[model samples]
Target: MTTASPAPELSLRDKPGFSDLQGVTVEHGLNTQDMVVNIGPQHPSTHGVLRLVTTINGEIVKDMEPVIGYLHRSKEKMAEGRSYFQYQPTIDRVEYLSSFYDHYVYVTAIEALADLKVPKRVEYIRMICMELNRITSHLLWFGTFLLDLGATSPFFYAFREREAIFKLFEDITGARMMYNYFRFGGVNADAPPGWLDDVRKVINELPFRFDEYEAIANKNPIVMDRCIGVGVTSYQDLLDYGVTGPSMRACGVAQDMRKTNPYSCYNEVEFDVPTATEGDVYARYKVRMAEMRESIRIVHQLLDNMPGGDSAELRKLEKEHAKVAEEIAAAKKRVTVAKKNEEAPNAADVAKMAEKAPELPFDYRTTGQKVNLMVFKPPAGEAFSMVESPRGMLGCYLVSDGTPKAYRVKWRGASFSNLTILPSMMIGNLYPDLMAIFGSLDIILPEVDR
Candidate 1:
């Protein structure tokens, strides 16, 4: 193998869509040396501001190193001083494409620390929303991956359905993207009237639309030529690197956090975890398509068995419980002051005032029980939380110093690990195959940078 010295500076250009290098060639001969080319940081094909310093011999790749951190946001550090509830919104930005899953994992961690019990109805609702969000996220991946591969029509088609899903989210959460809807013990509120019907319509119509997508893209010879056998990461490689989600599932591993860990109502939901023996870009694509269908199935079940309960009622109950606690504390303080003074206000007066206090409103009784709404204080304990985010396994390690704030928060993002296998997959492949390989890895830069 010939080695070349690194170039001092390289000029990079951004191309709108993918391109195939039909006859382009790097200089190669017995006396010739390899050349270095910088593919991105701005190139549209890298998906999101990723830079690859590639060493090539003729048309074949020799070695490639991925350069990241172009979009770094100090999410973990930002979480340090913020209260657990306050930090939840920040988590939505970590993986912007799949904000609901991000919020779910963060809220679940806080709930675990506080030992809060979520209502059964709330759990089911969360499952429905998250699964819907997962489908929307995968739709985005499908559309963008195709865009990276030079297919424009599929992008539009996929987004049309994705808009429907986003509208559903907006109806429930009042936001399309960064939905900070999940609360500590439950959701911010319940789904609005006809929300179930909207979800049902989407779920009912999705399979046929997916069939249209497959007919248009899956069997296309060009897509197959670009995707098949490209960006292959072996099962052992994925395991060693701690990859998860459909990316790992594409490597023949059936380890889904929803299935293995069974958070929320995933354990009760019936769906198959899709897997592929080949860990190539095409296999990852197939896995995502299968996962979308599974999501539809889960949503269908949720819609069919939609529960009948008032979300406002639950919030009211919680508020009433809090009021009772405050009243009791105030009464205790008054009694303590009376005992400290040898002479004090009349006991009968105090008793009468306490008795005359207005009875808790009946509507307040509907609110879910008010458990302590204090800041999160984990018991000097450490817990590792992982969820099957759209990209892969998103993990958050929390070490609490017996305070409302986390002492240390370490995020183990799947995109970070999945990106590591790129150079290995890139070696020996042609230049255009790099786009195919990178698109197949299905990473979100924000999550990786976080």
Candidate 2:
């Protein structure tokens, strides 16, 4: 007899990539059931201890719920328990990549409440540190983002440049990562001898290195394929979600706080807020790349025309201060002796000597107003200050009970607001594209959980 009737053709859902989940099926005979996947809480691509409760159908992500709080260190609560100065060191851990920005917001918030005036030189130094920090932070992002996409060489290249900057930091701040160098009205110490020159040499060489990195990773077919069309959102969507920094700038919105609201010496410096209209992962990449160059430009300008004189001039000023201080002290002592003893030679002359005594040449501009930081207490009022940090607008809100410690402390970290948009961007994107999209956001976990 004839061969058995051909078996009924199998549905497309029965193919290799498809998996049957009970009997659920779509109109085309494709499986419609969803599969849940946990991408993090211990994964590498997450960049931190973030858990993504992702739902997928076959290879397509249907939904994503970010599970945060894993890295929470009770940073905000700690401020209330410690004196203002005591809490200064802990701020470095909030967003360790750009802790200078953290210190700037916290210190300046208290400065506003206390009516503390930061010197122009201190402002210039702070601006320099911040822009250099921006470069380092972006370098790390550059390396890690590409590494997530399967490229390895850029990681080492990035760290090589990062180490150079860290060495400069070590020379100035005495610590690389946890730099508690900023203070209420001035920096903790002036830049060390030749430190700025070292910074200049290192900063000058970075652009060439950046060029090399681009040559290696920028045009790779895999990078372009994965990044160009993936993870796009509308300009309105970015603003609606409260996204900022390079992520929002990628959507063709130039909403940089540095440009919109100038803080510190940013008004004095000249640079462009790099932006792109693609709203995709590649657009974000290009924005940050341009930003690094802009930061370099800012650093060069500040260094060339640094407000404080060179180290040699500062040394001379210190010597002159010592001599003038001695003269004023002796004059005051003579006046006191003459007042106590009527027989002392010419009481009127002694008084005249005290009046004519040279005033001590104290550089309040460098040393600030010299307040007692240990018991420093601001007035009973609230104040908030914000700065354009590498991530976005980093802000600090403080409530003071006219006490040595803060009554309430709040931080508005850019990563926290930026992370909210991930689920919206990720849904409907392929599972493999998750890293490409998430990395573009550059969400650091401490900022999210703090």
Candidate 3:
């Protein structure tokens, strides 16, 4: 019983296996102890529901881990039950900010499967709308980034121009934010008559509007101090993390999906991929601003050389097909009545009329269908498609099981990869500098968690 007092009764708190404070420790050699903090799922600067668990040694972040999944919507699972046509609308939810680009990728994949050929005029229209959407997305990013850095007025100014672009989309697609416009063979509808003129007016006003925004935010000393030389992402880091779009261009990489991959008539357009050597927050900002200007230039060119044709030819084709079907039904009904009245035509008479029936010509070479509008079954294979979304390279890897729905769908979101490098940038930075780095990444949580 005396046995050294049974080693002080071996309290549960002292045992390694049972102790609640198993890994807790205090620094012995450091001048000041580090503190653990959470930046938040509620912090406005985080852009969405994101929590950063960080350890700070004074103002410098010693370690950080990002906690996500709060905005998860199970979009891929939702796509499984939807028909190919039905799923087109769901793409708008993947990256809510750049809904058109998301729709473009999904529609393009279906187009490839169905072997649909889009008209040249339709291609040009798609390019115009996509470029405009690109500019709008960039505008929102610029405004929000500036807001995170404590600037207020630029957000309003950027949104004013962004709203004009949204109105144009709404005019054509009939939906402002999430436009389920792009279809398997073509767009939902043709652009309105005065839409091109409205585009030109916005393009004309943008240069003056951009100049005003630049004066307010780009040249300000505070903005320069907060952004320049801060959150530097090296060219190699960008490549390693698979960053694209403005973020990669900011690091001096000239990889633009619109240029390299060249989808939706992007190759026909002439525009520069703006780049910067610094790879800092300011460089990303500069690249985005320059991109908006390039978008404006492309819009101007598109307006000047906008193709003129029966804009609603596709819709007309659908209507004509419907009419022909109705006529055929009527003829069948008449034949049935003639038989009932004992005046039915003989085989020779029926043959003569069949010979005279005009053949309905449908361009099915591109769309892989004999009829212009028909439910299609994609081949049992997989395809990967990428687009230059405002954030970065948005890619969709889809597998079809010879069914109406996709067997598997994987979204390679650029925001998810871009945000992975944030901790490295914030490692030795001050508290406020965190906002600058986070803002520059331009991450949308829905895109990541989708």
Q: Highest TM-score among the candidates is held by which one?
A: 2
- What clash pairs does model 3 have? 114-367, 115-366, 115-367, 116-366, 116-367, 117-366
Number of the candidate with higher TM-score, 1 or 2: 2
RMSD (CA, Å), each prediction: 10.7, 4.2, 10.2
Model 3, range 54-155, lDDT digits (tens) per residue? 988677787899999998988888878877777777788888888888877777776676567775566667778888998888899889999998889889
Top candidate when judged by lDDT against the true structure: 2
How close to the true structure is residue 298 of candidate 2, measured as C-alpha lDDT? Answer: 91
Query: Which residue runs of candidate 1 sit more than 4 Å off their true CA positions?
Result: 1-32, 309-379
The alpha-carbon deviation from the true structure for residue 230 of candidate 2, after best TM-score superposition, in angstroms, is: 1.1
Off by more than 4 A, model 2: 1-23, 26-33, 331-364
Candidate 2: clashing residue pairs, number: 0
Residues 1-450, candidate 1, lDDT per residue (tens digit)? 378868655322122222235323323212234788998899888767789999886678988998999988899898887876677778888887888877777767766776767766777788888888888888988998899888999899989999999999899999999899888777777787567777888788999999999999889999998888787888887778766778889989898988888887777778999999888889999999999999989878766654544345445655786686677556656665855645655656667766665554432221234544455465677767778877888878877778878877878888898888888778888877887788877888888888
Q: After aligning candidate 3 to the native by TM-score, how far in Å is the CA of 450 from where it should be?
A: 0.6
Models 1 onward score TM values of 0.80, 0.90, 0.81
Instruction: Kindly provide the TM-score of model 3 when superposed on the true structure, using C-alpha atoms.
Output: 0.81
lDDT against true structure, model 2: 0.87
lDDT value, residue 237 of candidate 2: 86
